[model samples]
Target: MLKVIYILLCILGTFLPYSQFLPFVLEHGFDIRLFFEQLFANRISGFFGMDVIISSLVLWVFVFWEGTRLKMQNLWVYIASNLLVGVSLGLPLFLLMRQFQLEQQTDTAIS
Candidate 1:
């Protein structure tokens, strides 16, 4: 049930943000460096951007360690999703998947 909630939230969150981003992408055409430059152009955005990036980096390291320890497949998929989408979607999505794996393991162990 909690996994379902995470999945739903991931879908909705990704959709809403990306929908708003579509027009911006059409105008800007996928320039990452330029995006970073503009993102840090202001003091406020700079602080927030740096905060998000550092947090994301830390999360990625932890995800890699734990995912490997748990032998969870598609770990790279989560990383790719993080890169392609955003942490808001990827983090919960990874948690959803991790929960699914745990549920399966528990069921199998019980059986």
Candidate 2:
């Protein structure tokens, strides 16, 4: 049930953000300057932007530490997902993988 929810979240995480972002790319053709201009255009937007930046850094550190501790492979995949999308994709994805790994460990221990 938890895995199912995580999978659903992953689908949502990818779809929701890209749904908003793709149109921007189409309109601006990857205009980084304009992107930043609009992102920090107001206090609320700036707050969200700064929050995301801090969250991303924290996610990176968590991905490294916990992922390494669990011997999870392909840690870069989480970082790449984070870069390509955001925590929306990365967090749920990592949780899904972590759940799978934990399940595997449980099975191994039982066997």
Candidate 3:
């Protein structure tokens, strides 16, 4: 569940580019273009990028830790492992995790 939330947050963060056009962001004097340019330049942006990477890595490690805790049988742990892989591979893997969980629950109840 934590992994799912983290992946969802990453997807949510992608929409942040559009947030620059919002009145609140604009009111705060945020410059979208400059931000993107700096990101493209790969320079320090007050540790934002570093923090993102570090947090993502930590979340991924936690997912693995949780998996080991579960004896590799809990479906959620597998879903979480996939979520981490999805994050690493830059794929829409989280959505699949959600679908798998829904399907698994329904299947279990029917059995």
Q: Give per-model TM-scores.
A: 0.88, 0.98, 0.34
Location of the lowest summed lDDT over 10 successive residues in candidate 3: 85-94
Best by lDDT: 2
**Would you give me the overall lDDT of model 3?**
0.51
Q: lDDT values of the candidates?
A: 0.83, 0.96, 0.51
Task: Estimate candidate 3's RMSD in Å.
Answer: 9.5
RMSD of 1: 1.6
Give a tens-digit lDDT track for model 1, residues 2-107.
Answer: 9789989899868977896677789898888878888799999899888878867876987798888878987788778777877778788888888988889899
The list of candidate 2 runs beyond 4 A from truth reads none
In model 1, the worst 10-residue window by lDDT is: 16-25
> For model 3, how does the per-residue alpha-carbon lDDT over 6-25 read when each residue is reduced to its tens digit?
57765654455345436545
Reference-based lDDT, residue 40, model 3: 53
Q: Note the clash tally of each candidate.
A: 0, 0, 0
Arranged by lDDT, best first:
2, 1, 3
Per-residue error for 97 in candidate 2, Å, reads 0.3
lDDT of 2 by residue, 5-110 (tens): 9999999999999999999999999999999999999999999999988999999999999999989999999999999999999999999999999999899999
TM-score, prediction 1? 0.88
